[model samples]
Target: MPTITKSNIDYDKRNLSDKALLKLYYNMLKPRLIEEKMLILLRQGKISKWFSGIGQEAISVGVTMALKPSEYILPMHRNLGVFTTREIPLHRLFCQWQGKASGFTKGRDRSFHFGTQDYNIVGMISHLGPQLGVADGIALANLLKKNGQVTAVFTGEGGTSEGDFHEALNVASVWQLPVIFCIENNGYGLSTPTNEQYHCKHLADRGKGYGMDSFILDGNNIIETYSKVKKLAESIRKRPRPILIEFKTFRRRGHEEASGTKYVPQELMSEWEAKDPIENFRSYLFSKKILSAEIEDQYTSEIKAEIDAALDSAYAEENIIPNETIELNDVYKQFEYQDIKPNSNVKELRLIDAISEGLRQSMEKHKDLVIMGQDIAEYGGVFKITEGFVEQFGKGRVRNTPICESAIVEVGMGLSIAGMKSVVEMQFSDFVTSGFNPIVNYLAKSHYRWEQNADVVVRMPCGAGVAAGPFHSQTNEAWFTKTPGLKVVYPAFPYDAKGLLATAINDPNPVLFFEHKALYRSIRQDVPTDYFTLPFGQAALLTEGESVSIITYGAGVHWALEVLENNSDISADLIDLRTLQPLDKEAIINSVKKTGKAIILQEDSLFGGIASDISAMLMEECFEHLDAPVKRVASMETPIPFIGQLEDQYLAKGKFESALRDLLSY
Candidate 1:
């Protein structure tokens, strides 16, 4: 077992005043008492669950007290002292525990699963590692703004095993960001001991691997923790850099009240109990004549009364009840439609050129907009879309990120949290699977869970016509369209691509902008030279007809246009859906009602594709107007092959002709 070490630094030499020392004591004492009362409430069946931070109070209180109020913090569930020390309203915190509508997250989540921008605190999701990357983003924002703000993120020893932990640390060190990664080595991670977690002598030693400054201190010693963290924060503020500090501590209680500590040896618990941070500190204060029995009694009675009043206020509030309208309204910010039209100042450009021009205009328009991807700066990315951007925009705005997709995406979310626009390029849409967790779990749910807006645009270079194999070529729009709180935009033409991309960057929600690799250079159109934006959730009519309605997006739009061009006898109202999430269902219903026939096309495989949902919607909404059943034409349900012949056979283009003929004949 790892032994707890002590800090050799003398506390008498520290510059802290008596009042500051007393403040730290009160901060540490408050959480301990709050947690004890919460446990009693849990036993009485008042609160559903309580994660006790009884013995680990000093680490949370000390670190939080050291940071400035403007600096951001991402705290874990066990960091109640962080909240209490930050001075989050006690009544609201109690309401959050009791599931009241007035609490943070409006009672959407229990425990410390929500963040409050007012307090400069970004709470962690159950996935503890992603927050590290988020901290990097916040620090990066501060660095760019020259604010000298430091961000502190906490995690358990078990979190070190995660890929995000490594990715976040490496990125922070490489960027020399102002972030402090505090690892609370509490001896056990949900009953698994440190021996089973890793073979490292101390978790802080791993910081050397990332070229970061690291320290190991006695977490039970509150004064040492506060002094070290305060100094570290000051140093980082002066010369920004990442630091890792491992506080050797023990979890005297179980992970949660529900999980018992039976796995822990009795002797180990007894040993840690003897070194209780609060009691030890109180005794030391008494020895120094700084605290007396009467003063201690007064502090205890005042804190108890404060807790009792907060509890009474929380119980007085009404519990949260499910409301369909309110819940659905919280999913995404309301999008207003703008019919941005082209003018005389226009130039013929390929889809790629249109996108680049649009991005350039957006960068110029929004000074805070940042573009990040692998080799995007000097190398100009694999597609060369951001070529020559470094000279015009500089390396800060046009950044080359490490090949860490997951952390980069979280960083984008963090940038958004810091009130900046960010565009993250996934070199290939297929690689989005690596960064799926943060996009789906955090960014997509930020607005719904809390009032925080994730104004991030993820540029996905996708499609299968280039024969780049299964890994590089894929149409994955269906993956995000199915997820709520996200806007999925798949533009086909150059004009639509430029306009939609500009609009997505300005949108106040997470938008997955899918740009088909095949259409990037193949199609050209006269787009507006100046900035423009097209409305989302609105379908553009490429061809007007009355015989049938052909609905598609991305590469499918080109294939449907080809069918209409070849077969003049088959008159069809071709609908190109620019945005899939906020689908133009009304346009679809109206078109199908006029033509009495419908067909949905997609580049993705037929199974679980966006076509399936459109087909189902047509059936449900326009059941009486249909001449025949709605048909769906999509690529074969198989991984896209690399070879030319096999790829053509697997694509939806080959199947569209037959499906269109069947719909016409019917």
Candidate 2:
């Protein structure tokens, strides 16, 4: 299709009513004036930073006005008109910009780095690409609900280079989701020009490769942009599908006020300034006798007065004070621990079966629960854990995803934001590196930043066994345990696996559920068929003795049990910590205080592992009760080898018995 430039657009055939036209003009003018006021505030040192969308107001205003208020929009930093058009409270927005407690983030974040459920807007993170996938999730939810609600996500031409951009577009196209990929070609990404960003002539052209319809618009023409986007949104609502629209615009100011636009040519700046969206649109309205100079002046005066009053109200709000208790409270929603017991019906099942049962039960209980992963549908996944899920739940609940880990993970977060729970499976635990950004940066920080709950459980099949080599077998749980707003669950036995998995699914936070690939079919226990939940931050005592306290979890628990059973003379207390993030510190301390010695064991490499934290905790809390120095047994600090003997040597089991003997002798 041909690019829709201003000269080619049919101005005389426009369909917007005069009232709507006037309202759009007011919305565009408001943000432009607000940005000018904010720039002054920045110079006067009232606000620390400002991202001026001074000349690029039409894209945000037109797109927001075109969509229904119930449809979601994920906007970028410069889209201030989106907030203003959505009618977000100016005082609260100013308070947010000024780091006040009354802000959406409670002063935890700055600028447009927050989202509000009330407005159906998901704000962008500094990493500009992930929000596209989040838009996919919201669109997917709308499709399932048959709400005919479309999701529009924004990014710049530079963001088109990100892998997430491609992945999200491809997934949306394949799934035929109702999404509008809005790309604002704003000349440059920070300092890099568009020529250096992508080889394509226009970012919208890339959409054709994904089998998606594409369009290009003269972004400065507010009437053309609004009419085109409105027609596009209407078509998408009738027949759900993804569309890419490239808004050809120019940023009048620097990426931020701090970054001066020295690289932009003077001639180019003069040309764009002459075609200013708001000014040109104002002339159009005057020519059509839809607006007068008196009314325009009145609108400007009203907008300036409104901004000043909002700033005054924001200044009256209290600033954020650093308090350990209050700061920690917002990290995650509090979950009430319930020690639910299983009924009389029981059967022997392996760890994998228990987990499958837990997921099945949760799916039956919560209709909104979805399980997405590559090869998880008819293929049953790499480990066959989801073998019969598709047959039981159908393809809607049991869905298959592309090999796009990063986008899929963010899609799960978007699902959570839309009040649906999702479980994303990483084929191998080591593959989480691809999905790490959304999990650690977006999902982990969502609740703390905007009180957004990421109720998604990521199933990680981790550990070094089965000779799967470095790419497949890895115990990377430590990566997330250090990250706040996330729960890490690693269970040793089938009983704990079922119960803990249930709790993780039910919890209103992001959870990393690690299932040892080696233990999937190895150990079996009489697990209750009835649904149950195990509390986090609670350790299970496998054995009771006084020689030493063995703190371990996952596969380490079974190894410790084997060693203790073989050497009865070396009696010890074995503690299986089911959850890692909410560490069972009280259990560890009490066990160490009773036994007077402790040994922390883990399957991960020695340095930077969870063992280091537990060792430090034992030293700090139970130093006086210790009869000997704390001991740590972990795998060698190297990549897990593929050879059977080399892999065995790289694991913790080889040194477990020897380490315990030395600690006992000490």
In the range 213-244, model 2's lDDT, one tens digit per residue, is: 99999998888888899999999999999999
Q: What is the lDDT of residue 648 in candidate 1?
A: 97
Please, what is the whole-model Cα lDDT of each candidate in the order they appear? 0.90, 0.91
Model 1 local distance difference test score = 0.90
- Relative to the true structure, candidate 1 reaches a TM of 0.97
**TM-score of each candidate?**
0.97, 0.98
lDDT of candidate 1 over 171-236, digit per residue (tens): 999889999999999899999999999998989999999999999988888899999999999999
* Number of backbone collisions per candidate: 0, 0
Q: Give me candidate 2's TM-score against the actual structure.
A: 0.98
